[model samples]
Target: MSEPLKSEIAREAEALGFDVVRFTSADAADGAGAALHAFLAEGRHGDMGWLAATADRREAPLALWPEARSVILLGLNYGPDGDPLSILGERSRGAISVYAQRADYHDVFKAKLKTLARLVQTLAEAEVKVFVDTAPVMEKPLAAKAGVGWQGKHTNLVSRDFGSWLFIGSIFTTAELPADAPEEDHCGGCSRCLDICPTRAFTAPYRIDARRCISYLTIEHKGHIAPEFREAMGNRIFGCDDCLAVCPWNKFAHAARKTTLSVREETNNPPLAELLSLDDAAFRARFRGTPVKRTGRDRFMRNVLIAAGNSGDVTLMPQIEGLLDDASPLVRAMAVWALSRLAPQRLRALRPFLAPAEADPAVRGEWLEAAA
Candidate 1:
């Protein structure tokens, strides 16, 4: 593709609501493989075994698609209009990550990516493949290589123009477009992202242990949350944004211009009591178009129960009480934990009746541990 065509593509992407666009060679992502291997070797990825399963393919764009000669990295800003941490103080309400407060970004970005890909194909007569977060592509490193942003200390791509709030997408094509100069790391002396982690998920600057990440635990892990991190999880029901919210770079960020990525009022700070009452159908209806739906009713309720336990609001006892008999053992177990924290006396009183009826060993243990 000609340099003029690349400029036109950038103009077209900007018109499509993408905040940043740049190009890099497929080999620009070659250095990311070693770090990924090291992360998996130490099991830092935790229960996200797919990261291990797809490590080889994720290491290089060429491995993903040999036909790809150039990688076009696109970024869409989803900056929050207000302080994301303010919701954390509202302990009775759950704090969803700002990015998840809207429609699923994959759906939104994929459509835009497809449109841009079609434009590129017609202009360059090149074969194109587009990817959002779903694909096993190292978008952050590729974006950094493409001059979109540097990978911040939090390991998220942080742009000088968009701060820490950019959602990345990529288009790999057989066209050999001119690659942009790589962006330099600007996170020289800041450690706010590292220190602000609720679960201390970051082991060091730019390195995170996913097992301890609240986002990973709440959204990706399928089973019961570990007791050690429950108190630290706070009221974050969907995903944690402590590290991202604390970044000073966000000051330069503008509120998301895309209506599809804007925060929904219903999801902003939903009351814990209301979330606890959601059944499968109601949960689906409430989070139908959002990323939270991927967690399913059981896992989401389990997270809500954890928040309820941390709330210390004895008034939520009735809601917690009802979940004790929930069909999901994960919910029942967390309900016991929440009940124990909020109403230990009631838990003590109901133990004999509840204990004998509980068949799940984990649920029985929660009752025993709470009573003890």
Candidate 2:
């Protein structure tokens, strides 16, 4: 019963556009809880307090859904066609992460997961619960257990066929399907993922300190990014993908089957000048259905300002100066920093007017630092 049913489910999932389909028992993941606790204890998660908030449910499958006995893990590949790192040399452009260069995968995977979950319910007469990356589900560990891929040294799942580019989704079911053989780690002595980190985010082979990670600083960290990471950030205005792009296993990967998930031009390596010009409404309308919209205007502008400062294109001073008066201090502080870098004299001239009335202490401090 389990054999034929699992095969049928795999076919349907493939038909539904999932690149990889595999199964695992709904058992607790080996050491994910211990790792989570250690990560939280060290304050490595940064401002992502949600990781600690749902620590219990994130530890295991049955902990979240006790009625579950089997888990169906799905991998939807969104690998880029060309070198995702190629844009780094184009310092005047914003190098967005490959995954976020397209439409938001969370919405793309959720619609498909719901469709697949219904088929699983019919095939086994079982109760099913679906989860995407958003939930408390420990997706990478469970994906490894289900034979989708091994957890790479950089702590993301690395598929033999998809490299580190698979977006994981899961269906936890009550049906007793046999688990697939788990994949063993193939990282060997390669430290490309670890070495490629501009901010030295990897504490060890498999652990990451997110607070120092560029991905965290640019996207996750709400406050002003630290001075140390500002230059290392280069022109990556959104998430960083250096580790994933350098992997040797990407040779086997192909471009995504879904065109909607491919790297769209506007979000992929677009010019810093253009991005710096975006107002709140313009930012929303431009990135409407994409992942960039979720980061919202103020934070996104802060990142763009960092890119502008690093660009060495003094032409962006006007736009940087404009943001110095932005409503969000998150934007104004970074603008002050960027202005000092691109046009120190201009920033010094404006400091007299800007610093006195500044209500936000952080922005005022940026003004003082610019003077000193």
Candidate 3:
């Protein structure tokens, strides 16, 4: 009875454009709770307090929704057409993570998941709910357990077929569906992913500290960026893809279909000078419908200013200089650092005029630190 239901769900998932689909019981992902506790205990999750707040729900599907009997995990291929790391050499241009270059994956995958969930409900007469990244879903471990892919050393889901580029989502249903065997980890002794990190976010093979991760710093971090990470950040304005890009498994991956995620040409490696000019409205208008916009103008500009600081292009000096008076202290702090990097003499020349008037202590600290 459930075999037919699982088959129908699989067919519907494919029809809805999900590249891969698998099923698993909604039981606790074995030992995932312990790992979650350990990660939080060690403060590896950084500023993402939601992870700690929803530990029970994140530990298992049933914990999230007790009615959930089986989970339908899906992976959508979002592999980029070229090398994601090549942008690092273009210091004048900002590097956005390949997954973020287009439409928000959360929106794209959630729409397809809802479409697929309806089929599960109709076929088995069961209650169902769909989830993308927004929830506290342990998608990586759950996907790995469902044979969607294995969590590689970098602590991300890795697929032999789709490589590291799969955008994973899941559907939980009350119906009991057939479950797939868990995928085996094939990253034996392959240290490429861990070795390639710019900030060495990985403390060990599978353990990561988000505090040091550029992706976390540029996107999730809400305060003044730590001074130590600034120079290593390069032009990664939104998120870092270094670990994902270096995965050897990505060679077999295929680019995501345009219908699933259309690449926004304007955001693809936009000039640091141009990005520094965005005010609140322009930033929202430019990154609308994309994950980048969710970071908001202040944080996004902070990342851009870091990129400008690393750009070494004197032409960006004026744009960087203007941000010294930005409304957001986060923006102004980085602007001071950027000025110090791009044009120290100019920063020194303007210091007597600007330093005394600075109100925010963090911004004042940046001025003192840079002037030192």
TM-score of 3: 0.98
Q: Write one digit per residue (lDDT tens) for candidate 3, span 126-227.
A: 999989988988999999999988999999999999999988898989998989999999999899989989888999999999999999999999998999
lDDT for 124 in candidate 2 is: 95
Model 3: colliding residue pairs: none
Task: Report, for every candidate in turn, its global Cα lDDT versus the true structure.
Answer: 0.91, 0.90, 0.90
Q: List the residue pairs that clash in candidate 2.
A: none
Q: Model 1, which residues run further than 4 Å from truth?
A: 28-30
lDDT tens string, model 2, 1-372?
A: 379999999999989888999999999778987898999999999999999999888989888999999999998899888888989989889989888888889999999999999999999999999999889999999999889999999999999988988999999999999899999999999999999999999989999999999888887888888889999999999999999989999988888879768777778778888888888899998888788888889999999998888888898888888888889999999999998888899988998788899999999888999999
lDDT of 1 at 73: 92
TM-score of each: 0.98, 0.98, 0.98
Put down candidate 1 lDDT per residue, 1-372, tens digits, no spaces: 479989989999999988889999988464688989999999999888899898889999988998899999999889888888998988999999988999899999999999999999998899999999879998999999999989898898888887889899999999989999999999889999999898889888889899999999999999989999999999999999888888888778888877788788768879998898899999999999999999999999999999999998988999899989999999999999999998889999988888789999999889889988
Angstrom error at residue 270, model 1: 0.4
Stretches > 4 Å off in candidate 2: none
